[model samples]
Target: MHKTLEGVQQSATPAIRGPLQVYLVVLALGLTVTAPSRLAQVIAAAVFLGLAIDAVGVRPLRWLAVPVFFLIPGLAIILVTTPGHGLIEFGPLTITQGGVKTVLDTLTRSGASIIVLGFLIASTPVSTVIATLRRAGLPSVLVELLLYVYRAIGTVFVEAERMQTAAKARVGYSNRRAKIRTTKLIASTLFLRTIDRVTHLDEAMRARGYAGKAPATAEAESHGYGLSIGILAVLLGVRIL
Candidate 1:
């Protein structure tokens, strides 16, 4: 299989509007608001804005499970823990307006951020993201680690899917007990398979004059620089005024 860093190629001339551009935009979005009230409003605005961007690229729903997972846990924990005026009561359990407020505020920002991140991940490949960072003068050791970790994630996901398919073929997950056992087996197998892959990869790298650091990448167009500035201006504008 061919390799491309998140989506950044090691070409003599890199393309405009690369993964680095998207990464910077997301970073700016994260920094826009400081207070929960305004931040929550901005987050809602961002979600709407991101939907426009999503139409032109990858929709956030392409990997709906991830956002839902984080979104649920954040609300769940905050509802029980945040202190506020009581909105409702359930015997020993109380639901306060303060708790509800905090949950909404946090979830809005968190969910909006996820929307932006989801778009970036879905549109760009992992290799391109790491490669772009490497080009941005990141430390060699850090870049190498990022590269390996991204590859490992892809490997694990693929392995898990394959095992899941195999299990289904054998009626391995027909019941809850069977499903739990199958899941445990898949996790263990995936771990061993990843370890084996890493060992061979190290050997291959060493054979090819592998060092602690990766080689340098080529330059890309600065076209996205202007685009990023405009986006930041817009985001900050909404947050400030």
Candidate 2:
């Protein structure tokens, strides 16, 4: 269990903690967009946040994949949905100047935010993230779900890799029809295997006294309140100003 948690901690390092850094950066960007008068102060705050993450050992560009998967798509959605004054029209597609500007600003801000987050995740450990969440008053159920989902995905990937390797070793190059048949067989096998593993895991959890709820530890409840409060204050100030 410990090894599994450790491995998950490593894998989630870039994706999980990166968001926190991104949020901090976004706070600055928000102030810049909404309260240009406070731009200098906001920039200073952002710099301090960046430095703090560095002091805590966050790595840069560790969670780049997350931005690619999440931020870009979200920006695209904003661009597509934003209403515009008729500036460019083609058939049914009309883009207003205001919409274009909105899209551009959203994309730029989101991109920068994602980069900041990616850096943090690359540097912070998974265990520390869980600890942080616990400190922030996150429910144990959510944390346990996060951990289980991470582990389950890893297990599925390992199983799939093993199946692919076995198939390649036993079934030499075949015609298109044969290949399709082999692919289907592999897919079917994988599905069945995954179901079996889930069943076993469910049974094991039950045997080990898992009652649909994760127990919170005292350590998780004892996170640095002052730091959390400071971060929240920054976030709120950005929203208000």
Candidate 3:
């Protein structure tokens, strides 16, 4: 996670302040949810995707595939299960026009929302995000917990990579059965290791007079949002009028 974040930080465009990014994401999501037609949803998705690509290049778009892949099963169910004028009949199942429309609508909305979130995460630093959340009235305890989880993701990913490399060196994934066993071993071992690490971390924090409050990080000041605000207004106008 940290390595990926470092790559994001190297992007050509500087990210806007976290609060502005949050507002942009929220507006994009609102437009997506209340979109009157599929065309409107597509426009919303396209605009935000273009923004994301512009800010961080194409690196972050790869994460979109994960959600899209997971949506396939649900979208397929909607395609086959929803009743309407039949588009196709195959093996006692009928794909309907209405079902197809529903699927497209779902896809567009999900794509738009995900793109907005991806852009926000890719552009903003984690500390800025935490500060934004705190400013938005999130409880300190929840924020602190979230911060720990965010940091832990990097640790877990690093450990997983190291384990996978070592396993590969030992022919851990040489066959199908071996692959399954190796994955299980890695997961179990990772869990135990994470627990140990967390225990030590807790001890370290306590030793340093850790408190229940979240540590304060300097928040990025808002600036240069005129263009973004104008673009967002135009998009909203397109959606509404």
The number of the candidate with the highest TM-score is 3
Question: Which digits, one per residue and each the tens of the lDDT, describe model 3 over residues 114-179?
Answer: 666666665666666677778879898887886786556434544666777799999999999999
For residues 1-241, what per-residue lDDT tens digits would candidate 2 score against the true structure? 3223234335432321333533443454454445433333444446444544544334322223322433455665555566866776767766777767776665544454444433333344445445555655669888667546544544454455566568778772366776667656665676567667866887887899978654433222222345545755765565566
How high is each candidate's TM-score? 0.58, 0.42, 0.67
Per-residue lDDT tens digits of candidate 1, residues 98-161?
Answer: 8887777776666565555444444445545666777667787877886676556445545555
Model 3, residue 205: distance off in Å is 10
Clash tally, candidates in order: 9, 3, 0
Better of 1 and 2 by lDDT: 1
RMSD of each: 6.5, 9.7, 6.0
| CA lDDT, candidate 1, residue 225 | 67
2 or 3, greater by TM-score: 3
Off by over 4 Å in 3: 1-3, 10-12, 138-218
Q: What is the lDDT of residue 128 in candidate 3?
A: 68
Best candidate according to lDDT = 3
Off by over 4 Å in 2: 1-65, 142-241
Model 3: weakest 10-residue lDDT segment is 9-18
Alpha-carbon deviation at 203 in model 2, angstroms: 10
Candidate 1 vs candidate 3: the lDDT winner is 3
